[model samples]
Target: MKKSRILLSTALIMVLSASSVYAHPGRTDSNGGHTCRTNCTERWGLEYGEYHYHNGGSSSSNSSSTSKSSNSSSSVKKSGQSAKEIATQKAKKAQQEKEAAVKKAKQIKQAEKDGYADGLKDGYNGISNIGISKYQGAYNKGYKEGFAKGKLKLTNEKNKAYRAGYSAAQNGKSSVVPSIYQTNKALSDSYLQGFERFVIDVEKQKYYQMGYNDSFNMEKYIKPDFDNANHIRWYKEGFDAGKKKQAA
Candidate 1:
């Protein structure tokens, strides 16, 4: 009986160990894979690799899109600024052109006021400034020379012009003589009276040529009402009366 019990005990122990090995599904891999431990470790590693790849791909795509958007925004800003700059430049250029045109018009109007010939003489005064030195002396010289020349040129050019204007006016075309031209001559004559006196005092000598030329009809303007025959008759009467007194 004791021997029978021992055999039964040994058989029970062998069955328990064999059953534990066969029943455990975690002991070996199914589906022709490696051992359960090795397969599970490798599968987990593959899952980690896939996760990294997906994260990396998503990150890279997002980064690329973000970089492109930033670049586009910068380009848009640059293009807007470029347009603004171009518009600003155009505005400045237009303003400068307008100012220049206005200045030129003023100069032309001033030139026309003096007439064509006098305008030409004034241009030489501007050219002579290049050689002028000594502020006070040059200023005085330039002013005097420019004034004298301007007057002389105006007088010479206007002599025939005034005669022509007078003839035209007598012929009944009063509208032909510009008002500005008349005013210009009057202003010049007025300026000459003051300025010539000032210069004669300053220079202590006659700096300008005095006396009118032969063509100037001083008798016509200065002695318009004087009668030449009456003056001659009066002189003869006075001389005859003086001779009678001396003879008596």
Candidate 2:
């Protein structure tokens, strides 16, 4: 009873009694219509707000809850996307490195193949070119070129013979292999046919056969003329001279 009286006294002090009302923006005329003409929804919302404030009932905070949930969902999705992107980038980088390594390996293999000296020389003519002759002279300058080359080789062979003899001496050898050096193309071709004919004749000889098997490849070119009839004339003469000296 004492608490009730105290609450009543507090309400009586706070609540306004009947007094002269001020004529303001939202005031009504004698007819009770608002001067400012506030909207019905707006007035109803203000009345509802006043009722909530005074009653002190529990209020739902759904808007705040929905905003928080939306934010959390967005954050989760962003984090998941970041993880996937990072993984994808790593995979792509790894693939690039693998491809690069494969390319480097292929390049290395190709380089190794290119390193062979024999393969490097395939583009040029080889030792087999020794068989060619300056026989044809259909072109005007051809014969002159061949003649000039022959003359030059004849001159060079003198010097070559000295060198060959020296080199042969180092080997403690009595003979030279392919003893003539044909420095020029024409030099080789000058005695080409005569050399061929001499080789054919020597191969036919029984004594020459017992000495050396092949004839096309002679021991060396000799200055004393060679042909089919005189294949071993030089050799037999040399043998006879040696025998005479030994008997002496």
lDDT of 1 by residue, 19-90 (tens): 544232333222111222223234333221111121212234467764554444232111125677899999
lDDT of each: 0.43, 0.41
For model 2, residues 1-248, the per-residue Cα lDDT tens digits are 99999999887765533111222235433323222223323533332111111112222555565445434423211112567789999999999999999987666554443332222232121121111222222222333333444445455654455455445444455432351445433334433433443444445454444223332234443433446444455445454444454557
lDDT accuracy of residue 96 in candidate 1: 100
Instruction: Pick the TM-score winner.
Output: 2
Show how many residue pairs clash in every candidate, following the order shown: 0, 0
The CA lDDT at 198 in model 1 is 41
Candidate 1 wrongly placed segments (more than 4 Å): 1-134, 179-248
